[model samples]
Target: MQIYKVGGCVRDRLLGRPVKDKDWVVVGSTADEMLAQGFRPVGKDFPVFLHPKTHEEYALARTERKTAPGYHGFEIHASPEVTLEEDLARRDLTINAMAEDDDGNVIDPFDGQTDLHNKTLRHVSNAFVEDPVRVLRMARFAARFGFQVADETKLLIHQMIANGELEHLVAERVWQELEKALLSNQPSLFFICLREVGALKTLFPEIDRLFGVPQHSQWHPEVDAGVHVMLVLDQAARLTDDLAVRFAVVCHDLGKGTTPADILPGHKGHEQRSIALTHALCERLRVPREISSLALKVAEFHTHCHLLFELSSCEVLNVIEGLDAFRKPQRLSQYLLACEADFRGRPGYENADMPEKAAFQACFDAASKVSAAAFVNEGLKGPAIASAMADQRCRIIEQMLKPFRKNTGGTAS
Candidate 1:
């Protein structure tokens, strides 16, 4: 059996980037031959195994044919006759279709090297549109490498989306690609690519509808709600590698997309609308609880976070309690980061000063000292104890954050 290092490892190595994981393609081998070599059979639908010692995935070279609709419609044919080139041809992009021999020789059967040098994500063949999931994968690759999508590939993805391919994609697979892209260096590109081909409208209409929508010019200088969201998503990517925070930023302004036409740029009480849309999006995507929880909270109160300096101490305490910061301090940390992204995600606002995060954190720190345990010790119970604690926290926040009180209304500093 001949084995070759294939796919992302090859692409990343050629691009002078760090390779995270290695996938091998074994040509001229069968499932029995692999087992004879003590490779553990793990693939349910195809001939794939794990190396006994290295435990790296080694999939036998195979070809796939569409048997039905959706991503699961593929029928795999793995055999000794399946050549390496045929296997590479089935990959989503030219950059990911390249491979390397054991002697460190790259095998570029489809001019992947040229495309890589040009930083272009082109498909290897017309078969690129066979699977609906490629629509999301292409966008994900764009986000990961910041590479330009080839014109033909864009057309092919559009063809796929236009023919209801996106409608057939599994929600889990869509979220998988989205989750990975959100953690990428240029995550906004993922959604941008999707929107370019109209797949965004089909798959995530909540997000896609944001593109042409107007925003309050005074607050969002970019004036387009969708552009604002992309900026926020990219800002979240820059601030940290936290997926929840980035995902929250993505959903924070979804309500703006559904604003009344007459309202134009002014979206009053958009947060409440945003919360409902965010909940629907989370439910549709089957988003993980940890991620969706934060998304919902950010949707509900991100503006509140922005207006922290102008808010009364009681309001500040409400934000802290709403986030349950005392119990899950980590939530507050992530919440603050997402709010900062929103605050700075506007044009000419990326470097603006945001004092709301720090002041609110200070408020939380001082108010956290007003413990329920102390209230309980005073024979307070249930709602009475909660009210007393809320009052004390409000007082502490008022005293602690008084100096930052201003009419900034969380706008760009």
Candidate 2:
């Protein structure tokens, strides 16, 4: 059997990116032969093995035929007779179809290297429309690499959407691709790419509807809610690599999309509306509770976070307690990051300093230090102890904001 490094490893290497994982394609290797050689079988639908020593994945060179709709309705064939060329032809993008041999020889059967040089994402074959997941994957790659989708590939993606292939995509697979996109350096490109191909409407209608929605130009110079969210996502990526934070930023403005048209730019009470939409979107996608919880909290409290300076110490503490900041300080920090992203996402404000973030963080730190143990020490029980804790935390917050209130000539509410 001849083994060659294939897929993303080769693609990233050619692009001068750090190779994160190595996948091998074994030509002229049977599943029984691989098992005999101590390669552990891991693939359920195809012949994929793990190296005896390195434990790296080794998938047999195989070809696939489209049998039905979606990504799962494919007939996979792996045998000693399957050629590596045939296997590579089944790949989604040209850049990902290239492979490399042990002797350091680059295999370019589909001109993937040329497309890589051109900074283009091109399809390998007409069979690209067979799997809907490929559309998401390609969009994610565009976000990661900042590459332009070739005209032909764009047409194929449009055709796939027209054929209703995207409707067959399952929620888990959609979220899997979305999570990857959210973690990319330019996550907004992921949504832009999907919008270009009309897949966003099918997969994320809530987000898609935001494109043409108007926003107050005074606050959001970008003027479109969709563009504003994309800017927020990019800013969020700049602040943290946490997927939960990124996801929260993405869903924070969903309520704005549902604003009454007569209201035009004003989004009064949108925070509550956003909470409901966030829940629906999360439930539909089967998002994890941790992420959904954080997103919901951000959706409901982001406005409160922005209005921290105007709120009373008690109100600020209430927002902090609503976020469970005392128990999970990291969530509070993440919420601040998402809010900062939103605040700076507008045009001519990208570099604006956020004094509110620091002020809120300081307030949270002071309040978090007020221990409930002291109330318990005074023989306070249950609701009494909880009441005492709230009073003490609010007092601490009040003291913490005293200096800032002087500078602004504002009194506590």
- True-structure lDDT of candidate 1: 0.86
The backbone clash count of each candidate, in order, is 1, 0
Worst 10 residues of 1 by lDDT: 404-413
Clashing residue pairs in candidate 2 are none
lDDT of 2 by residue, 25-67 (tens): 9999899999999999995987899999999999999999999
- Give the per-residue lDDT of model 1 (tens digit) for 7-100: 9999989889899999999999899988998999995987889999999999999999988888989999999999999999988888889899
TM-score of each: 0.95, 0.95
Candidate 1 to native Cα RMSD, angstroms? 2.5
Instruction: In model 2, state the lDDT of residue 18.
Output: 95
Per lDDT, the best of the predicted structures is: 2
